[model samples]
Target: MDPAPSLPPSYEEPAYRVFLDSLDYLPPTDVERIKSAFAFSAKAHAHQKRMSGEPYITHPLAVAGAVVEWRMDADAVCAALLHDTMEDTGATKQELAEKFGKPVAELVDGLSKLDKMEFASYQEAQAENFRKMLMAMARDLRVVLIKLADRQHNVQTMSAMRVDKRVRIARETLEIYAPIALRLGLNKLYRDLQDTSFRLIHPHRAEVLSKALKAARGNRAELLGRIQDGICDKLAHAGLKADVFGREKSLYSIFRKMKDKHLSFSQVLDIYGFRVVVDNVPTCYLALGALHALYKPVPGKFKDYIAIPKANGYQSLHTTLIGPYGTPVEVQIRTREMHNVAQEGVAAHWLYKDDGESSADLQIKTHKWLQSLLEMQSSDSAEFFENVKIDLFPDEVYVFTPKGKILAMPSGATAVDFAYAVHTDVGNHCSAARINHELAPLRTELKNGDLVEIVTSPKATPNPVWLSYVKTGRARSKIRHFLRTTQNEESARLGERLLRQELLSLGVVPISIPGEAWDALVKAGGQQSLEEVYTDIGLGKRLPSVVARRLLAREDIQADKAQHMTLAIHGNEGMAIQLARCCQPIPGDPIIGSIRKGSGMVIHTHDCPSIRKSRSSEPQKWIDVEWEPEDGKLFDLRIRIEVKNTRGVLAQVSGAIAEAGSNIEHVSMDADPERLFTLLRFTIQVANRTHLAAVMRGLRHIPEVTRITRERGGEA
Candidate 1:
């Protein structure tokens, strides 16, 4: 309790000496093993010293001390002691493996930087680090946890180091580690790290931000106190046993609130709030109802998560109520269990994992994602890291199926993501949707409590256009994989066409070419036969024009194939239209595309309301293009509108879009009724790009329109 009595005067590995005594749990053998690891690391780092003039062993020992605070195991403790031995001390992996066991050495290796490996850019190096971490995370999540612990300690002492070094490390921690912590559900660590990093990286802004929050909070103190007291009184009056604890938004949460919602510190409601923890789930709703009676309930600010747990298993009943002071303050009603889940997130699973049978079920039901990472390792490290970042965002939505089944997805997830989430087969064959009984597109963004019904067919396939509209990385990645496969099929088709043209150019039809000539041609091309040649061309490694030239010279084909395979058929090289997915340009959203010649297509939300509002007029380069299909070609679109949150708000919005004959693809919302505002971003589809502009017009006609915008280029 007294912090393991700091390093003894005789301590050579002072850091480890201190750590060994501090941990609450550890066997005697484990202690000696850790100490020995510490000694070896010290010897390896003998030449190094800290900015504070302490031996380098102090750093590893310090890191190990922090790991002890997390109640980490013996192996983790030992690895913490030797974490930098391989990185800065020039200790070989073989040497560490021979000295420590393979596991300890492997952990040290994972903690080691890839500074030795050359990369194309510093960004590449950072990206690889993130990628390696995802792979490591999939294997042993403890590795990154240990790394984060190490980083937290390093950051605490960074002030003693160079200013430039402090800023660099802090910025990386802010951008990367903080996000990782949140993604992994290490809420306390994540928040603390973000604050610390903010302090170091942008100290002035952090200071100004801190002061602004304090001033605003100070103004609300009396009102918030009354609300807290009122909640306590209501709980007492109802004879419900509960603990009502006042919780203010953290500084980082406050900063994010201001930045994200474009609100001044004073303007942000729900900054002052209280959480009432009851004994059971039933009591949570009872408390919510009581609070609503006590204060006029703010419309559309209510969320019932007890019936619908978050992707991370957080459950609560949240509502904003207009209080005695005429200001709307939020009250979160949850059972103690729910409160724990809300704060600890996945770590809360450890409480359930304690019981043998429950632990198995917990792992089974909860860790489907952990298993997915292993499957995801088929991707490269950077790609894997990108996936991790995508998956780690904390906001999520819960929607119901017609049969009463619930699906938990990230906040921005579209129907496309939902399809892939349900099953790869379902995603591939998704043809239509019914949200609470109306047809919707695969890109539909679902809201909490919507009864979503996905319609599938054997005929339909994953639309490549869904990539633009899909929000979740899982859906995006799956759509990409399908598209890649589709591209291969297209390429193979084109390749065959080119081959026939080459034969024609030589004035030799495939049937007319004699067996001897074909065989000679195959041999000259260093291939097995004509099939191999064709396959290579299909795979894109072989050039059809080159093959045609060789065939002409050797009399295999004529020179005219060059003109037949003419890729230059489109004379005026225009930037082809490729749709941006942020707002799919279905008949419902604005659409634009800037041609990047040579690149087939690029798309943007038509007159992105955000951009249109940001700029006075549409820019000159907003080129127009239509969906080129003979029939309807699905166009993904994003439609964002500020609407009043009320009963059937989502259904009404979806209904309006459905009335326009477009399908809802994906939808998301950031709303607090206390502010009389909710930001809803939606993705849907129509016959072509033309349908999107009409959708925006329709959204504007909706009564709740504070603003509606599409994601387009030029403004952002």
Candidate 2:
């Protein structure tokens, strides 16, 4: 494409001509629309000047030229030209729509930021604006394409801005835009954004690194040429025609490698590489073989991406070889299609302008990532931003399902993360996992190529602990949502029970809907409805007595109003109610409930010292409670076994617990060198008092076990 002949050789016309020439790939009608848009933007911004003292119109023109270089659609080109008109000038979206078209107007609207809006803080404003742009990008990807072009131009001319402003914009580009570009497979844009941002953010470090890189390039210039020539000659001799070219590693990328690996400039090898572009996939392997024949391939440095494409649809064969003078020169071999996708990412689809397999594949992959943004929108801003950061990483590990289907997950992802990646339901009900058909913990870090089979049970549900190890946003969000919902339900149930019991003791039977009483209660408590009051009580935010008193005061007092409400007693009550860890209470034990703020009720053994102490302090918070027997419910118990200081005493005690059909969840030993006995604490899961008694009886038969007692409040 050449510059448009319509423009004369003038300072202002060249930028528009560059954009015009790039539009040669478009139809004449589309080209004229873009030109019209350029004219409109130029007129709208005629009085405006950039901080660099150039006409403000030049920035959009430059962005349009870059978009055209990416081979974006004609609508995208028109949008690039007029993106800022609505934000900066008096032009309206409807007017742009009337002049250009609806698509162009929509694209322009998406590219426009929220500079006119108010926010709590600069970070808040930035996050909100970024979120708006992402929402627009999710609707139409062209929004991001133009946004990237705009950022690239801004970063290019960033020196015109103040140092603080320059650094802020540069950091945004690096932390946000560059990662998005990389994720979209826009390698060219990604590298440019990264390099520009690095230059602006750390000028001195960039200069030092650039100098070191220039010196390294000069020293290896001959070696690089020889390696490229050698690979080309080998392919030619092998009867495989290919296009071979050398590419220098970007400065930011080199710096990242050094910083991440803690290396000095001298230790960063493979500063530049050669790429072999062929016609098809088979030739990619042939080129690889030819390269291996030309030089000794480095061990463990060969990667065949052709077999399994990257998450971004990058397919290639990478090999690091020992070149002349023992220099390690990395080489990548791929077909022409792979090269296009690798360089342009999703944009290559539009650049190629094909609805063929490559474009469709890239489009589908890109849409999945965009859809994730929508999924993340419901999260709080801080969490959403953190999740976006997690998505920026390009490294991935390919694991397989039990049926041999492959799944690409981030590095260090756990089995629970994979379970969620498979499906949210699977993750929610996942009890255990089988890695390579061997039982593995849910938190087991998955390795590449490992076959994972999730073992789910209908009774199983998500554990709060899973949040600590999960790597993906989806898993974390789902776990939190489930736990939050469960907590609310549990808290509400416990609160209702406590309120009914307290009202019964006060000789007041609370009704769900007592008309004037309910209204007065709602007004007194400042709640919308009775459910709100109950939920608040459940959350420990408000006490049941206050709410009950408010309701009781609304109605005339009557004698013999007492009534009992049955509360369900299901063991292991999720996260709503908990057995006091200090007491280690079992169902068989005489237990009382204590209302804990924000944590609902905590059940403690009546004899527990912790409960005795609490009775003296917050006696009003304690409530009488009784156990309801339910079959097959396990209770946690801590028992201390005092055994003679004999070698096999520990083994005998463990065997007795097992014989009594109790599972020892945990065990700890304390040896008293001055005494003849060892105090061993064992945490066991049992059904009830009968089961515990059987275990105690079995242990008593063992002569080495001199004394045994259940532990409560850190004491036996």
Candidate 3:
């Protein structure tokens, strides 16, 4: 047979051929169509290559193969093949539609990126990328499934790259892809992606910890095998027909368990577990009972998901057991239908033709919450992307409404997020919540199946503090939206207060800043229409100084006798004080304490903006205030030097400052990058303006110095 004609040894072929041969599970035509799609993709990506040495076609094939295992429709298979061709192969939408059909073309284009010209920032770019992915997911949920498959393949192969690139890929996988997969209920893929990325992202810890896991699995091998067989034997003895299987927990799940519960490796006892699947729900209970009798069950570790399924449609009876030799073991019992739903999630109905009331439509209705993301559109891509991230976050707590309807909510969600998820109006008008027949605060954390009642009144409105308490995106976003609408009210009050304060400082009547003039000033500011003036005022863009300056030349406005607020040597000209060298003053900063000395009442920013805010915005603080003709000798300010020293460094620094303009009073050197690192600091004389700037420029040009900034002393 020539050894099967010596295959090309494709990376994906071995795993994929298994799926291809499962033809009885799929109609022959559908299977052939999938193969043709793969062949087409191979040609399109024939010459293309990934960062890894594999043919780029292998990625899409692998993605399609994953979807096939899910038993998705032909359109999904075709879409997976053409997913990246539009973006990377210059393949037009028209060509895709003509060749593969309209649904496939639409999915491909939806997954494509926005043109580079549209983005202004990395945030905007990310948002656009998410928008594209979301649009794809909304149209064909299979798009996300395939995308996740691609991400999984990439993460699995991330180690075949450079160190920095590996970290970057792992980070993206952790931050974006893993969260999305988990949100879509692909637990197995999500776990693999997370664990694979974590291993690379923190390799050293992963290795040592992985070694411990291997040792523990080895040591507990006998106990786990006994527990598995014991459960199978007991179920058989009870006449309950079932299949039992055992597996260990993923490293990522273990790591997360450790981090969240503050448990050490040994403390995690539920790592190795077995699952039992019977033919029906009644049998599932029978199996559970059988297992319980076989081994003593652990306390407070049982869950009945069959009665109330997980948010992802996973239904099982979970019970921890104390097996032979005191080894703690876990067991899960579920019916065959429940097992399929648990493993395949929403896609299971499509594959198995679940006998229920429009299972596909029910799945869609159940996932309307996810679909609502596309409907609640935002003009700013960045905000929209952020909302998607918040929306897709996994790890949720399920609770019941007062009417007994189950509401799945994000972990740490309050009653507020629940109310909003039910209806926007209910959330906006929410006044209070009751948990388990007791009055609970709106911030009360909800647990599984707590009957929550939301109280609403006609006068109820979202409060600003709700933003702090609400954990879900819907509540936070709705609250922010409502507040933004009411900013007009905030604007008028804030503007009036600021105007009044400015009038008091100028010793003038507030009425002199006429409302008509205020309207005109607002109109000229290029804000959204007119009333936004007040919103801008509330948002702090309308400065009092600017308003004062605008109303300065008014006939009724009076000017106050205020000092120039200059600084100089203690007791020099006009009894004035110089601005403190240690601190600079800006309009938004507080001013304090008059000094009759070096300069009279030297002006200083009450709260220094330097440490609190970046210096970028306050160039005006670089002042012209001078030392009054020296009534007292100059005070020394520490100057820092950063440079390369090769002998004569101190002499060169002192000479440079003197040559450009000032006198050096003292010199000091500090330990830097290393003991031998070059850095020389000198207290130089800048009697005034010309001398100060000259010395600075001279010091700046010195070859060795890295950076020089003013260092503050103890006093103001």
lDDT score for candidate 1 against the true structure: 0.68
List runs of model 1 lying over 4 Å from the truth.
1-18, 50-54, 92-100, 160-172, 214-221, 279-286, 335-341, 348-366, 373-384, 507-543, 551-716
Total backbone collisions, model 3: 27
For candidate 2, lDDT tens digit of each residue in 592-701? Answer: 77777888878887899867776988877776677887888888889998899988888889998999999999999998978788999999999988899999999999
Worst lDDT 10-window in candidate 1:
566-575
Q: Which candidate is the best by TM-score?
A: 2
What's the true lDDT of residue 421 in model 2?
88
Candidate 2's error at 197, in angstroms? 2.0
Please provide TM-scores, in order, for all candidate models, with all chains considered together: 0.70, 0.89, 0.68
Candidate 2 Cα misplacement greater than 4 A, ranges: 1-13, 43-55, 89-91, 114-127, 160-165, 270-272, 376-379, 512-532, 553-571, 588-594, 606-624, 673-677, 689-694, 706-710, 713-716
Clashes of each: 32, 1, 27
